[model samples]
Target: MTDSQDFSNLSNRRRMTALILLTLTVFAIGTAELLPMGLLLPIATETKVSISTTGMLVTGYALGVVIGGPVLSALAGRLPRKTVLSVFLLVFIIGSIVCTAAPSYGLLLAGRVISSLAHGTLFGMIVVTAKNLAQPGKEGKSIALVGSGLTVSVILGAPLGTLLGQHLGWRFPFLVISLLSAAALLGIMKQLPPLPRSKGGSLKGQLRIVSRPDFLLVLLITIFGTGGTFAGFTYITPILERITGFSSDSVTIILLVFGAGSLLGNIAGGSLADKRLVPTLFGGLILLAVSMAVFTWSSHSKAAAVISVFIWGVAAYSIIPALNMLVLNKAGDAQELASTLNISAFNLGNAIGAFIGGLVIDSTLGLAAVPWVASVVTLLGIVLAIWSVILEKNRKCDRLPEYPFENRTA
Candidate 1:
């Protein structure tokens, strides 16, 4: 549990404001992060690169997040949380600027990498900050609020950016995100209180977390489960066009439906995870598997496609808060370490998902098979999730103190 004093010090209104501000930060970053997915075609056309090459930009950003997260956290150790956050926002701003103004594919890719350097650290820090701001038991809700920020960007920002890119050019979307990032920075500075610096951090201390099989298994769940979501989602625009027979313009609107589902799912996941962590997690996995499998076949029908996408949206993001809580609990004293690693693992998963999705596209499987592959990957993740739960129970049983008569024969 967080120190009660931390939760008690702030007024409810201020805490809510902090949550809104943190969520906006996520929105700005999330929009920029995913903008490539919606604008993939335009970027490839204008940059004179193949679509496959454009896909690598997404992979590059993921790699940047994985690399930047730990290094930034280590460098900022014991620093003021607000100052560190400000620094990250500045890095994001610079990256967006570079991306927007780049003259060629190489420069655009460079800019994307710069912008992504802030992602992992920002997500990890904001989540920790949001949890601290919540009133004790509402930690999951606060984390979910942050998740909603990211999801809402998909709902609103990414699609809007996509719409804008279709009209003006891909560069324009990055420009719009740059403006959003500036507003988010101002809001975060004005609203967010000084948060406590995390303690007990060191490279050695961080690396030592992998020794815990429970923590490692949870990360594996993250890679495969969330990776499965990315497998279907990262290539969504193409899937809608080639299989569902939707026009590009219609794809934009459908993305909104997907985004709405994400918003609802984020809230439900947060609320339910706070209420009951284990059940919410298991249920979310089950929901994701079913949705992906259905989406594979449902792509043939326009109405069914919409329903499948909405369900996919809900099932996809709903697992985040529960998963984060699970990892935090399993990590014990190394909360920050676990949080940052999980953040990096998410992008690592993204890179893997994108790569796998690309292979499916290039192979005979084509776009129609993406959801099926995603479903299979996610179903496997469910098996790991169940194993983790059983492992946790066994670990707890092992830790029980021996009594005089209990287990005497054993």
Candidate 2:
């Protein structure tokens, strides 16, 4: 083999290694993000706060991500990607450490917010960096691969942390996250190459791109699609318990099944997005709506509920890569800022879905109606997706040169 060919192979190997480290970093971060949910009761008891108040930890973190993502991305505008990643990981480590040592609920909430401030920007940069390092035409796959960490966290990391927290204490989970973050930080500094900053023009220019109708439409789709999923998901445990009449242990097993579905969905979505971006988006949303709709009726039966839940998991996560790719494609030079904004859009969707779900539960429609509501929300996203596609086609056609003979004849 030629020496150049050998060097090319080595370079690919290095990139894969770096990608793996980034994925691991995201796993740690994702685990930290969701860990509080399982430990809420224990944390509430220890901190002398009501369980509802304890739930604020999750809310606060999501709010922090929405508010802090773009702000931090703007602040780090000109910094090297490697430097920004390392700094963000350091901030995450510090926040996790704070959570580990906090003596009161307020302090714990503050630590969660601190950790969350790193979440959006970290994910944005990771997505951008992964795209850059990917082999040609494989950007979608790389993003999916990096994002798989979050799915895996749902599947493995968060559950393991919850188990550890149950045995050791709520603080122990945070402590483990801190250690993981530190290790990831060290790996990043050593294994990752120095990446250049995105050419995301001025902050004002980036904002202009973000405000464009096409981009806004993409964000809307993200918001509605994610919101639709979370609308039912936020209350899935209750739905499983009350409607499906599953035991606590059975619920746990059911969730594992859901996680397995998520992992499979992530892989399938990423692969398909790499090949057919727009179609993947449309199909994913369609499947998501259908799954949620089916879930409404399926919830009454144990076997059917489990089947619907698994399909719901698959449908829910499948659109992520397509949505992310849409942001990158639509944002042009402002990809980094756009990517960060998309992250915020996702978090905003989560808050909206949970809020709407809560409202549905309180109203006469009650818990049984959550799935249908979620299905409707997803259907709205499909409408936006259709509009976006039409606009895209028009834009493409507009770029075509007018034929002089055709114009003369017509």
Candidate 3:
């Protein structure tokens, strides 16, 4: 073999190894973020807090992500990417340890918020890093490769944590997460090559990118799309029990089905987005809307409910890769900040959707009406997506050349 060819092969192998470590880091991070939900009852009991107060763990984490992401991203902007990622992992490990040892509810909440400060920034950096490492035409797939870690966390990590908490104790899960984070940190430090510092853009310049018409529109699409899914999803357990007449065990199996569908959707979305960004976004939203609408009636039948739930999972997660790519494409040199803001946007949408769902359930509209509300919210996203596509076509947007296939009617 030629010397240059051997070097090229080695480079590819190293890149793949780095991507795998990043994916593992993401998985550990995701599991830590979601562990509280599965162990909420045990945590509340042990900490001597009400269940509602225990729920604040999630709320506090979300607030931290929104308020801290931009500040941290900007502050770390000039640091080497590897350094920033490693530091984030260390922060996560420390926070997890704090949670495991906290003697009071307030301390536990503090640990959660501290850990959450790394969530948005880490995701933003990881997405951008993966994109930079990707082969020219495989950017979407690379992003997907990292994103699958998060999806797998939902499917496997959280459930396993819950089981561990049930068998051992709630504290055990946090301890496990800390160990996982430590392992990921070691892998990142050893295997990942040094990445260059970001080109420092002025605060005003970063703000300008955030305020751009196209960029703002993409963020809005993310908000509405994510909100629509969580609207019904937040109430899924009750819906399955009361409306679908399923046993508790059956609900677990159905949720597993949903998670499996999300994994598939994440993969398919990335591959298609590489070829056609606009079309993939549109198709995902349309599918999401239709599935939620169908679910309104389908919930009456067990078999139909399971099928619709799977479709809902697929449609809900399928837009993520495309949306992340869109943010990077539009953010110019401020990709990290833009990506961080997008994560905040998603959490904002989650809060909004859950709030709206709660209001609907408390009112006369009730649980049965949630799917219809979800459909309507998703339809608004569809409208915005359509408007964005038209604007792109009229302006002959640069996205066309980026995706190659997007030059055709999206």
Model 2: CA > 4 A from native: 1-10, 400-410
lDDT of 3 at 115: 92
Put down candidate 3 lDDT per residue, 1-410, tens digits, no spaces: 31112223337888888889889888988888888899889998888889999999888998998888878988885677889999987987888999999999998999999899998888888988888777766778888999999999988999999999989999899999899889889988998776764465676788887887877888889999999999989899999999999999999999999998898999999888888888888999999999999999999999999999999999888999988888877787687889888988888888888888889899999999999898889899899888777776666664443221233224
Kindly report which residue stretches of model 1 are placed more than 4 angstroms away from their true locations once superposed: 1-4, 40-55, 166-169, 201-203, 237-239, 361-366, 400-410
Q: What tens-digit string does per-residue lDDT give for candidate 2 at 1-410?
A: 31112224448779899899999998998999999988999999999999999999998999899999999998887787889999988998899999999999989998999999999999998988887778766777888899999999988998899999999999998998999889889999998877777553787877787888888998999999999999989899999999989998899999999898888888889888878888888899999999999999999999999999999999888999889987887776676778999999999998999899999999999999999999999999999989987777676579832111111111
Tell me the TM-score of each prediction against the true structure. Answer: 0.88, 0.93, 0.94
Q: lDDT for model 2, on a 0 to 1 scale? A: 0.87
Kindly provide the TM-score of model 1 when superposed on the true structure, using C-alpha atoms. Answer: 0.88
What would the per-residue lDDT of candidate 1 be over residues 182-239, giving only the tens digit for each residue?
8888887888777666555465765676456767888989888898998889898888
Put the candidates in lDDT order, highest first. 2, 3, 1
Write down the TM-score for model 2: 0.93
Candidate 3's displacement at residue 139, Å, is 0.9
